[model samples]
Target chain A: MQAFDIEVTLGRTRVLHGVDFTAKPGQVTAIVGPNGSGKTTLLRATTGEIPFTGRVLLNGEDVARQKPWQLAAIRGVQPQSTTIAFPFTVVEIVRLGLTAGLSAANTDLPVRALEKVDLTGFENRMYQDLSGGEQQRVQLARVLTQIWQPMVDGTPRWLILDEPVASLDIGHQFTVMDLTRDFATRGGGVVAVMHDLNLTAMFADRVVLMQDGRIAAQGTPSEVLTDATLTQTYGCPIPVNTTPPVGMPFLLPQARMTREPC
Target chain B: MSLAVDAPSVHAPPMDRRVQARRLTVALSLLLAVTSVFSLAWGASGTSLWAAMADLAAGRELSRLDRIVLFDIRLPRLCLGILVGASLAASGAVMQGLFRNPLADPGLIGVSAGAGLAAITAIVLGAMLPPAIRELTGNYLVPISAFFGGWGSTLVLYRVATRHGQTSVATMLLAGIALGALAGALSGILVYMADDSQLRDLTFWGMGSLAGATWAKVMAATPIILAALAVTPFLARGLNGLALGEAAAGHIGISVQLIKNTSILAVAAATGAAVAVSGGIGFIGIVVPHLLRLATGPDHHSLLPNAALLGATLLLAADMIARVIIAPAELPIGIVTAVLGAPVFLWILLKRRGALGL
Candidate 1:
């Protein structure tokens, strides 16, 4: 899938300014940025949740021209946050994916998706009762249920995740990242917004560094994760280091020293 | 973190919520049936169900008084109660789902108030219309006016609430309150101009009663209410999708705008027809859907139909209480529903104070 020269204006502010993005099949493309840098805006535009001036192509079809259900059959999205007011059970919440995908007749898929997200016995648990991490996983399960297979009819489906591990604990974060990697390895396209540059280096096949509504850099993780680029994009002294064994980039932020101490 | 956890089981059989929903539907249907039968028999004139059933079974013509009381009065009243109850409650459920707030009711959106004001306008000022126009509207004038009023207010409120393809629920709710208050103030002014006969008509109509139920009234409302109810099943999937927030619902293939428009239109048409027929019967709209949500966990597929049945039963029971509690004097049905429903509403508020973020 590809987004070409996308421009989004919310009211008077142009949130995204002529951004181009591409996520290839069998690859995890991570978008990392500071707050208010338009990562979410770009994700929303790609998913057709928000309108954009340029075209987002899914399987070479213009997403803006595609019907909602047609889009649902190919790509799944996990929004940054979802506020559910009612007391829906985990299974009930997951079942919505089937209804959305027009695959409501596939009753077993929701359960399978929940199990995939490590929520095997939570079918009847109230959604509001779940922890934030659990709820996030439940949402992932929902998206997984929608696009169950990584590849369908020789075409790769896509998962557009906005900070998929934002609220997760370390263990669950690793679990979710591993799951995305597995999806990509199995020929699914994954475009995720990441706050953790280390995780992006570890898991993402390619990285796009966004700063102020534009892609500041896009390349292999090593090429994109230089100290100069990180410091410039994040506006902080973020030194980059590489793990010796696996050669994955990591960032260490130096805390500023204060003269007056308590 | 190393991937050391055991593989999650993938073979757990999913619970069939459909079966549970079916069971609930059947149970509510039976309860409604029993309540309907009881409502049919227990009326102002001391009529025995055994005798009515026996008379009908024997194929004998009912006595003049029995026929008049049974066919002319109680039966039509019962039908109207059921229809109004179902429409109001189902509309409430759809509204709650559309707003994604359980507290939302049909009345909150000004449909009932608008309908009531229109009915009042027809009652107090309808006589001054030219003779030709008056003759043309005939008996159907108040209801038609009420329906238009309901539709008009809802359209105005919807327009006010929605901007750039998004409906702000806070704006919708606040605007609805303002619209309803304006309509009510206007209705009050109309009330001041009403004569003694028109005042009496207004009083009964305002309080809501099944006493004036007629076959013609029932026929007039059935098509609109039933159409609204029939559209509910189609809405079930979209409403369920909406349990997630609107943007997510849209991402998941729901035409969010289409669902919102259809839901609003259905709620307006159903509530308009109901308020036109039965006056401002309150509580069933708020209470019935809430109660069913508590029991059934807010799946609209079951919630909508169950709310319909329970609403009908509760209204019939309330109408029964309104009739028998005061006997021939007859308390207004709306009064009975409020008396029964207000406490439950308060209880829900208290119980869910934390959940509601109050």
Candidate 2:
């Protein structure tokens, strides 16, 4: 899958300006940047969640032109955050995941997705009763229910995760990351828009940085996470160190406001 | 750092568990069918369930009085009961979803008042109009005018409230309430202008009844009512996604505008058709879906169909009670429903504030 020449404008602000990127089967691409740098906009564009001027090709067809249901068939998405004030059970909430495919036949999609997220055996609990982190897991489980692959082989699935583990504890964070990695190994492609530069460094096979609605930098984690690029994109001095493999890139912010040291 | 934030999990559960929601609908349908038939059989006018059953089994000519009570009166009454109940319930469910509030009801939102006013005007004017117009008065003019009233005000409110594809529920409800009061005032004027006999008929129609139900009216209404029922399933997926709120629903591939607009139209159509047939029944729409949601999950696929069923059943039961309570001298079905529905609804309100435990 590839985002080909995408442009997005939201409420009078040009959020993405002619950004181009690609992710083929069996690889993880991470989008990392500071706040309001357009990373989330880029992910929204790729998923066709927002209107955009560009061609998102899933094996070469334009994504925008596809029927909504048909488009959902190729793309799986976990949005940044969600809220449900109504009372719902874990099982009911999880069932929302299977909505994408009126035809997907995996009866075990919720179970499998929950188990992967380490939320097994909590199926009958009230969602309102769960803690914030647990609710996030159940929402993730809902996605599993929604994006189940009916056929065993040959059809590729693209998972778009927008900071899927930010709310979880350290243990579940790694578990989600590992599951994403396994998804890639199984010939799926994942595009994760995350804030943790360290996690990007550890798991991302390709990295894209956005600033002022354009691709600020794009390459491998080592290529994009350099102190020079970080300072340039963030408009502040940032220090980068080659730490022990923390499974994600580790970037230390040396400055919060000053662009340069005295 | 904003960069440190990870997205909450997007793992949607498998469809099988959700697929089970489909069963809630089927069961609700069966329940509605069972209860509605039972209620229809339980009416007064000295016709017991056994007598009705025996009559059906015998298929013999009824005595003159039995025929008057059964064919001209009871059958029409039963059919109208089903119509009014289903109408109120279906419209209530749609309005609640459209407004995204548990408190929204056709009666409370002023839909019934708007309809009632329009109908009263038609009845008052029937004398000045042609013979055909007078013939349409008693029960007919009321529903037609009420239906118009419901849809007309909705159109005006929708025009004012909707902007660039964003429709706020708060605005719609507030507008509906305000407009409903205005309509009620107009209806009150029509009632004042009504002559002595006209006043009596108007009062009964305003309170709501299935007494005037006839096979002719049922046949006239079946097409639009059935069409609306048939159309609801198409809205199910959109409504389900809508439970996530408008923005999320849009991101998930729903045209939020279309869903909202269609719901407005559907509510108006069903309520209007119902009022044209049964005057104005209150509380059924607000209460039935809330009750059904308690039994079934909140998913629209289940919620809507069950609401339709329970709505029908609840009205049938209310009509039965209306017939039995006063016997030879029947009471309005609306009073029975409100009397029973209010306490149950209040209990629900006191017991649980949000969605039903299910």
Best lDDT among the predictions, by candidate number: 1
TM-score for chain B of all predictions: 0.89, 0.81
Quote the true-contact fraction of every model.
Answer: 0.73, 0.09
Q: Residue pairs in steric clash, candidate 1?
A: none
User: Per-residue CA lDDT of candidate 2, range A1-262, in tens?
Assistant: 7887899988998888898988766888998888988889888888766789988888678776776667566666776765553455777667665666643466567777777678876776777778778877777666656655422267677777888877887667677777777778787778888888877877788989888888898889999999999999989988788364668864343222332222
Instruction: Score candidate 1 by DockQ.
Output: 0.46
Off by more than 4 A, model 1: A242-262, B1-17, B125-141, B155-174, B195-197
Q: Write the per-residue lDDT of candidate 1 for residues B9-60, one digit (tens) a residue.
A: 3334555566777898999999999999999899878777669789899998
The alpha-carbon deviation from the true structure for residue A105 of candidate 1, after best TM-score superposition, in angstroms, is 3.4
What is the per-residue lDDT of model 2 for residues B1-358, given as tens digits with 9 covering 90 to 100? 5534532223333233345657766776787778766765565556565675687699865567677766677667666667667778888888777665665687777777776777677768756778886675544555566667778876777676565434555676688788877987877888888899888777776668887778877865666577777778788878777666565565455677788778877787788778767777888988887766665556677677778877887888777778778777889887887787778768866665544322
What's model 1's overall lDDT?
A: 0.85
Ten contiguous residues minimizing lDDT sum, candidate 1 chain A = A253-262
Candidate 1 at B240: error in angstroms? 0.5
DockQ (C-alpha based) per candidate is: 0.46, 0.13
